[model samples]
Target: MKRRWLLSLMAGLALMAAASAQAADPVRIGFAISKTGLFAAGTGSQFDTYNFWKDQVNARGGLDVKGVKRPIEFVWYDDQSDPGKAVQIYEKLITSDKVDLLLAPWGTPAHIAVSGVVERYKFPMVGDSAASVKLRELKPGNLWFTTAVMPDRFGPVIADALKANGLKTVAVLTPQLPFALEVKSFLMPALKKNDIEVKVNEEYPPSIKDMTSLLINVKNANPDAVLVFSYPADSTLYMKQARENGIAAPFQFVMVGATESWFTKQFGAATDGIVTMGHWSPKVAAWKKAQPFFDAYEKQFHEAPDYLDSALAYMSCEILEQAVAKAGLDKDGIRKEISTETFETINGPVKFNGVENATTPASLLQIQGKSMELIWPPSIATAKFEKKPAWPAN
Candidate 1:
């Protein structure tokens, strides 16, 4: 009788331990991001921000899943910057790997590509690193953009900003990629509305090695501002050639990439005053979480986060974390939660209308000294718009 009682006690203890272990299972979140190819350089902000969010959550005991807590285990793959590859990877993560949740890929192309996969699988995902008018097609649910960088709003905000700063004419150098083209499409009309002349309008292929010719044309036109609708590689190229070629425009705005730490590291003070498309900056006191995230990211990576990409990446995670905590990993529940909730992000409040972010205003950022500052729309402007300084003679 004594031996049987001891055996029963041991069996009960073992069962309790088993239940505890099962309850603590890691929540597997899966994603595919550009690890190589054209989009690789831009992925660090997004990929690292996701990991940072994971580490921060795990450090605080783990993600709250309704009443239970679980450590996050990322099940990830590289998409090589191919949209088709991104779509394939998501399908695999859902159907084969069976991840509990999904995160987004790195750009407009990838987001638009994976939108179908999420919709088909009935999986809800919050996306960063993408902005386009095309995202409006993925209506009503499943995927949501945390970025307010839609080109339709972006174009007019820039035109208005330029007009406000006393710029009458501009040279527009656009790349043939989907995002840039969309930006140019709306910007032209906004420029007309603002009565800003497009003194030099040039379109280059994404693979173009040289922008010396374009810059020369821009120089000859001698517009008040030079706007290159460029991605990272060409953004770098523009800085290098613009310095060497001396494409001096008082107002210089590269549609993307100026806020990247590498841009400043490479160009030093030259990166200062170069405007870029972004809404978030650590300097904004109103965004209570903004500076803390900046400090944490810099502490972890020993490099500043990309103001646009990293901030959006983190905001996407925050939105997802809140959704999971409330909805408990059920796909339909998570979808409904995300669809209805207004998430507080480092970029400010994010609420989705269809696939677009409705609450955050379309805003612009400029690299000012060692900081990126909001300088648009007056209401959220951290600092007034300033003219880009002359390129340093090397």
Candidate 2:
């Protein structure tokens, strides 16, 4: 009886040991994003892209930490596009949930708010969306790395396009966001240098629904070009109002909404000849693998991916994955590695310049026949520019 009892006790101990050995913790990544709110349209695409990356990584047995493969898990919250809410959620992610790593929230305002919390926690975070020159000014100690193109770079590109197209005058309408404002700031000098006269510059609140007066004023100014720098919804509203008010310049350069499939579908052929910024297209040869990424995204999402959001999401994860592999899961190690190394991603080689900014080249694309065609940077242009017809009578 004694011998049998001892054997059973030994078996129990062995089983417990085996169970302990088998229970490995997953690598948890956390962030707050706009599931619903003003930023929802863009964040929705970003969320989908992050999920797609997560699935792809987990399918391959997750991230390689040192030499062992651990499954990846995400702990996220909906910030509802509020910076205050995002800050609160990020604090919880750091202290209570205790995520293994962190990803930046959706836009510049949210990111700016959450950045303080990240700094305190010293988590290595990759920012996918936010790109204000202010981020560099903050000098956040390399804890944060940005994936999106900086506004400073965007101005010169747009100026070049304006000069190339023989546009001598422009009117600017921008949302009063840090990134948009920075873009405008950078653009003004370039515009002046390029001999383009600014006829009218207007700032609108993001929540402003009616742009009738703004469009009317712009139409009256009758500049050779009109530049609209706003988010998707505002850009859409502006375009709708511009069309309704018969406000068509020889060159209309809108920052957002123009590249989106939904935007094109909503306006139909009316979207033709309207130029906007594009980060990646299948036609871009910088990353030969861009076509494959585009195909995979469409197959996974059942729609064309938003170029900026999709590229930022995929490349941000890719950089994080690479940094982890090299740095062995230590936050400080990852931060140092990311700050110092240039990551090769689907967006091509991303090397951080001074002020923690990385150069992701921008191209101007025009809609032609319900399709986005790269028209600027003739070296990489997929299609030539098509002159816009006069706005249809309201």
Candidate 3:
């Protein structure tokens, strides 16, 4: 009986020790993305990067959760490109699903809508695929945008770039949307400051399928530069119509779609010298991680990532990963770390000031030859700006 009792105690001890050494459960992070509807074209890169980041983390012994390593699992829902629906989905992720962390949705309106949900629950979210000057007004603790392209400064940035390049007059065609309109509001004022004459100024709906009339107006005005403040859907429309209408502006800027890799692939040689929005580029030697990320993403996805949204998404992920490593799973602790520390990202060191990324400047990207290169804010520019060559007659 004494011998039997001794053996049983040893067995129990071994089993408990084995159990303790096993890995902890995955850290469940949740988000809502527009898988269907209007914003879907733009959402592809942001959504892909979120999953890519998750895969990379899991491949390398999981994420460090305050020194305790745990794999990441995502609980995401499609918001159908509706802000109201995005709000409802986030509420479910927090209250019902009880996810440990939250990621942002695509576009300004959705980000704005979901901001309230995160705030009400005091759930911290690092924003991706979103930005606005109005973001400055929101309470700083719960939400912070990863992008520096807040509309308040975007206009001035462009106007400054054009002035530096010796472009004299411009035609501005803005979309009827929160972010685009805000850009127009500031850009018009900045143009006056620069003494650049406006030959044309127009606004169209986000759902607009025809830009023939507007393109004609732009062609008729024959300004030195043409600015089409367009989202993806309307961007495609404008590009097709502009080419057909024989728009001759040497400097042409289509706000959103041109930055994505698909935009270049589809337009091919026609894409050269077109300016759009973006800051980070793999060609920049200053940011150590930029090239590696570009190579790794192209390898994994079989294509180049979106210069604007993909960089923002991955950068936000890097910030959150670092914050988690420092502060663990506690909401308040993670929030504190993100707010106070500077994170090393592909965009270089990012430090937050209130709800905005205070480090990187508002910069514009021009698709030159085959790659997107920074053309604005000469401090970070990868290449000199090139004039838009005449479109080939199709």
- RMSD in Å for all candidates: 4.8, 4.5, 5.3
The best candidate by lDDT is 3
Clash count for each candidate, listed in order shown: 0, 0, 0
lDDT of each: 0.90, 0.81, 0.91
* Model 3: pairs clashing at backbone N, Cα or C within 3 Å: none
Among residues 3 or more apart in sequence or in different chains, the pairs in candidate 1 whose N, CA or C atoms overlap within 3 Å are none
Which consecutive 10 residues in model 2 have the weakest lDDT in total?
140-149
| Model 1: residue 366 alpha-carbon error in angstroms | 1.0
Model 3 is weakest, by summed lDDT over 10 consecutive residues, at: 17-26
> What count of clashes does model 3 give?
0
> Model 3 off-target regions past 4 Å?
1-23
Candidate 3 lDDT over residue span 1-394, tens digit each = 9999999999999999888578678899999999999899989999999999999999998999989889999999999999999999999999999999998999899999999999999999999788888899899998998898888878899999989999989999988998999988999999999999999999988899888998888889999999988999888887888889988888999989887888888888888788898888988898999999999999999999899999999999999999999999899999999999999999999999999999988999998787788988999998899899888655
Question: How high a TM-score does candidate 3 get?
Answer: 0.94
TM-score per candidate: 0.94, 0.89, 0.94
Candidate 1 wrong stretches, greater than 4 Å: 1-23
Show pairs that collide, candidate 2: none
